[model samples]
Structures are given as C-alpha cells and as structure tokens.
Target: MTMEVQFEKSFYPISSWNQGSQPYLASILFCQGRRTTSLSDIDLFAHFCAAAVPNLAMVESVDDEKIANRLDRVVASIGRKPLRVLVQVNTSGEESKSGVDPSGCVELAKHVKLGCPNLEFSGLMTIGMLDYTSTPENFKTLSRCRTEVCQALGITEEQCELSMGMSADFELAIEMGSTNVRIGSTIFGPREYPKKEAN
Candidate 1:
C-alpha cells in the first residue's frame, strides 16, 4: 500500500503540482474553490481522482463550522481509501478567514474526532501570517493549539503533525517542529501578483 501525506492550503501552485502527480501521491485540494467547498465538491474531486488513479492519497481542507458535517458526508460517500483532513486554523483572526481560532483549535479537533470517526484527524493546518516578522509568533500560537488538541484527543505529539509553515518562514516552522512545509517560491520562484495599472 502506498502512503501519502499532503501540505494544507497550498494555494494554486501546490494544487498544480498534485494535479500533475497523482496516484500514490498526496494531493491537497483547497477549500477555497469557485465558491465555498461543499461536501458534494469534495466527493466529486476525490471520486474523480480515485477513478483516474487508484493509488492516490487525498487530504481535503476543512475549516470552522463546516468541518463536522462536510467530513462526515465525504468519508461516507468516498468509502475507505486512507482519507485525511487538514483542519485550517485562521491564526491571523481575519474576518474573511475560514479556520477556527488558534486558541480554539482543540475544541475543533475534538469535534472532528467525535463527528467524523471514519476520516483520520492526522494533523492541524494553518496558513502562516502574511507578514514575515510576525510569522514566528503565529507559528507558536498554532503550536499551542496543536498541543491542546493532542491532549484533548489523547494522541501523542509524534502522531500529530502541526502543519504551521508555508512558502514563507519554513525554517522557523522547522525549528518549531513543523513536519510539513508548503514550499512554493523556493521551488517555483516568486508568485506574480496582479500589477496595478498606471494612475
């Protein structure tokens, strides 16, 4: 059996890589799709990939209130294929964000455990703060959340992967015990932001 692991909320760049490398590869499909990702969307995506490639490993993203029902429904629909979920915690506490607060991630993780027994609650996922200087603190906050979640769930720290790093601040994340890092710029160069027109 092929074991696959994925980095969460990788944006389009990471998704692009997974699209190219399927079957026995860990593919991360973000929740920020055409609209908010629903259970049906997850079903379609997972089913499509599993059909095309038998050995594919998939980790779907979930945030806040949608975490419970969405995960439950998806796992039931997809059947057993080593499904894992990325619990996105909005460490920045932005209004437009979808994840639970870092302070409350343990409660969220507990809900995930109780509600979606079929899916494996492999780890916690957070998008590092945009401001590089503040990224380390954000990672620490996520670390605290992961600790609480592990304690609540009675899972060993070794079994839990606190996915708290990204293209930015990957080294700090490593220092803080981030098992996975979503590296884009390092591999693909700087992202091209939309150019503002001349005033």
Candidate 2:
C-alpha cells in the first residue's frame, strides 16, 4: 500500500501516519494537486523525507528542470536521497486538471532522466477525466508514453513505472500495466477538506 499525503496543514501529520504503516507501505506519494509551486517548498519535502518512507513526488507541469533542481537541493541539504519523480500528463486535456500535455510527456520524462541526476526518474502518471468509465483512453495514452520514454532512454519497462488510476479504476489500470495506483478514497473513504476562512 502507498499512502497519498496531500502536503497541507490539515492532513494528519506524515510522521504519525508513517509510524503505523511504514512496513506495509511501498511508498509515500506527495501529491501537489494544482499547486505546482508547492513542489518547491523545501520544508514540505524535508518533512516527508523525515518519515523514511520511499518517497514519490508528483509533478503536474512541463517545467521539469525547475522542479527537479529544487527537489535535488532540498533532498541534498537534508542528506536524503533524491525522491522518485513522476511526470503527470494531461491525458484528458481538461481545463481543470493539472499535468503537462500528453504530447510533451516524453520530453519531460527524458528531461528528468538525463538532466536531473539528483532525482530518480521513476515514471509517468495521469489523472483521467472525472468519468470513471473513460479511463481506458487515459491509461492507453500513459502506456504509450511510457513505452516511448523507455525506448528513448534505452531502459526496459521495469525501470520506469506507470502511475495511473485511482480508487475507481485501479483494477483496469493494473490490467493495462500500471505499476502504481493511488487508491485512498476506496480504502479510507472520501477525505474531508478543511474549510476556508474568509479573507
């Protein structure tokens, strides 16, 4: 099991969560949501590293070089190994989603592999359209991107993971060669968001 921790103040602290589940967890995934700038927040990265879970960070934009550089610095300063990075591709082309365009996913993955020595280029991920039934196209797009990325990097599929699917479509994702799936709601039920205060 991999835990998806939203790097926000309201979620239960990662350290506490890790203590109970570390042995069972494959990795701790830090999802930045639409807040791409949060990826550069060194304190957040440090907080996660402290938990000692194998870390995976999701990037929702195409500017991988900047994100990778920031992550490298943060990990290095804390004496932690670089976090595995996933390039989130906008497979559905929805205005509400966060990710690089599908057309640019290979380029971003290649950038992380070659340009960011401090980071491990783990793989590609995509949050499909809201409709659960429409996930196959997104999975196929990610699979194709992964194949192209692996070919370009001269590495086998095992070297890179495909982080597609969530609670709803994980079974289908696994059938289509997904190495990682985020299934928080299915296991824990829907999350309660902190209410916003008036400005």
* Clash counts for all predictions: 1, 0
Error of 1 at 133 (Å): 2.4
- Which tens-of-lDDT digit does each residue in 46-129 have in candidate 1? 311111222234342456646456656666777765456657788777776557777777877777777777566767777755
Which ranges of candidate 2 are over 4 A from the true structure?
1-63, 194-199
**What C-alpha lDDT do the candidate models reach, one value each?**
0.56, 0.60
Q: Which candidate comes out best when scored by lDDT?
A: 2
Where does model 1 exceed 4 Å of error? 1-60, 192-199
lDDT of 2 at 194: 100
Q: What pairs collide in candidate 1?
A: 24-55
List RMSD in Å for every model shown: 10.0, 10.1
> What local lDDT does model 1 show for residue 186?
47
* Deviation from truth (RMSD, Å), model 2: 10.1
TM-score per prediction, in order, is: 0.65, 0.68
